[model samples]
Target: MKICVIGLGLLGGSFALGVRNTLDDVEIIGVDKNPEHSQKALELGIIDKIMTMEDAVPQATIAVIATPVNIIEYQLPFVLDLISPMGVVIDLGSTKGNICKAAEDHPKRARYVATHPIAGTENSGPESAFKGLFRNKTMIICDREKSDPIAYQFIKSIFKDLDMQVSYMDSVEHDKHIAYVSHLSHISSFALGATVLDMEKSEKSIFAMAGSGFSSTVRLAKSSPAMWAPIFEQNAENISEALGSYIEHLKSFKEIIDNKDMEKSTQVMNRVNDIRRVLKGIDIKS
Candidate 1:
């Protein structure tokens, strides 16, 4: 089968690599707005060839939209218009509500599947791509009932080949859940990184004493702003709610510390440690 992958950045390049590694008889055609990214994907052997979106969609059995959420919202309908009736289009974007809603009323909506692979590092670009990036990760399919059964099954099989555990949810619910679980984490990391950097200007040798815990806490701050800024905008309501709740919790903890209520603070820590039980069910590495 021939697959056309749009936006040959980290997610797209890694997806191309994962598919190529798992499927022997597949041809991967890459499309990127950035010519440099397309050329780099070709040089890295992530795609069999680079083609314009206009040229690639017609030849592809499946077209994967791995672009930023905003671009996915803009380009998906155009892609659906170009692909054959039998062709399937899948989007691997982070935010789902806007992208899904964009194509909701299209006549060829049944040919499209909205998916979010719940995985990635705080990295971007084709050079960061690698095989098995989605292995053991959660792949969420939104509004699966709206997609044609055959198309849904085909894309599910492809994610299965990449070793992903697939799940289903409504598009709106998916966006709301991810705002807390995924988006809020990035915001926290970014805020923490910024706070530390501001402190470092006044306390010049601060980073020299930084340890692994600090590095881990701020890791997601390294994620691409070009990608994340759109996501934050698209899922603004839910993310804002999540941030408010997080801030309230932080204030509560601060209250406990300010009051010197060591026992209450310890109780709060012990209560949150219950998350370890939840994490044990997932394949989180130490």
Candidate 2:
């Protein structure tokens, strides 16, 4: 099998490496908009060769578009046009509705599979990629019925090779759920980081007093904005809804605190403490 990865960033590079580590009789070709990333991916053994999409797509058995969500939307149709008749195209972008819609009208839409792997760190670039990044991660394949049976099976086997758990959902539902579990969290982290930095400007002791809790809470703030900004924009409605609900909770908590309603505050926290069980259930499932 021949694999062509469109972006040689963390997800793309890690996927290529994972395929290389697990699959035999395979070749991986990488395409990056940035020449520096192509050189770095090649040097780091993330891919066997670096080639342009025009040269790479025709020969690839599978083309993985791992670019930012917006770029993926713009280029998905073009990639589908260039892919061989039997070839499959899988995307590792976060938002699925826009991506699926972009290629839905294409004649070769059956050959495309929209996927979002619930994995990553607060890092970017090929250097940050590793062989096992997707292992045990949940890989969500959206609009599976739209893809050809052969193509769907191919992606399932490939995700199995990468040691990921697979789930299926409608593209719209995928975006809505992710807005809460993924998008909202990133926005919260970024806002919290910004809040702390602003406060720290006047209080030099803020950094000195920072603890592990603060570091962990703000860790997603270090994620690449180039990748995330597009997601926030693409899923704006769902995100806006999530934000509204989150803001209401904040307002309620603040009101309780300002009014010195210790009993209500304790009751509210006691109700929210169920999250411990919710998280524990997720861990067990994982």
Candidate 3:
């Protein structure tokens, strides 16, 4: 099988590697807007070769769009136009509602599979793509019923080979849930980083006190702004709702501590401890 992965950033680069590793017979080609990323992908053995969409789309058995969310909106339609009847086009955009809506009524609407693999690191570029990034991770496929059976099966096969567990949801549902679990987390991390750096400006000695907890929380703040900014804009309404709720929660906790409401503060702490139970089921290493 011939697979062409566009956008050789962390997601695309990691995908190319995962596909190639799982399906040895599969030939992987990478297409990147950045020439350097293409070169790095090849040198790192993430793909068999580098090819353009014009040269690869029609011939490829599958085309995966791993670009940023905004670009995916415009790119997916063109990809659907290029592929044959049996060719499948799957996208790994973070936000799905807008992109899915864009391709809903196309003549080749069935050829597209809208997916968001719920896994990543704070790193990017072909150089940062790593093997096993998708392993055991949950991949959300939105509006599966709207996709062609063959296209959907083909996509399912790819993720299965990568050891990703699949879950189905409507696009709107996916967006709403992810706004709280994923998008808001990134925003919080970024805000936290900004806050700490601001404090450092007044007290340079604060850096010496930084520990693993601070590092872990702020790590996502180093993620690519180019990739995240569009996601924030695309999911603005849901993200704002999530942020408002989070701020309100934080304010309540602050009031409890400020007024020395020991009973209320203890109640809040115990409730928040449920997060430890939730994290226990996941394989994240602290």
Tell me which of candidates 1 and 2 scores higher on lDDT.
2
What are the per-residue Cα lDDT tens digits for candidate 2 across 1-286?
9999999999999999999988898899999999999999999999999899999999999999999999999999999999999999999999999999999899999999999999999999999999989998889999999999989998999998898889999999999999999999999999999999999899988898889999999999999999999999999999999999999999999999999999999999999999998788667645
Q: Say which candidate scores most in lDDT.
A: 2
Off by over 4 Å in 1: 284-286
| Candidate 2 RMSD computed on C-alpha atoms after optimal superposition onto the true structure | 1.0
Segments in model 3 whose C-alpha atoms lie over 4 Å from true places: 284-286
Clashing pairs in 3: none
**lDDT values for all models:** 0.94, 0.94, 0.91
lDDT by residue (tens digit), candidate 1, 1-286: 9999999988999999998988879999999989999999999999999898999998899999999999999999999998998999999999999999999999999999999999899999999999878988999999999999999999999899888989999999999999999999999999999999999889999999999999999999999999999999999999999999999999999999999999999999999999989888764621
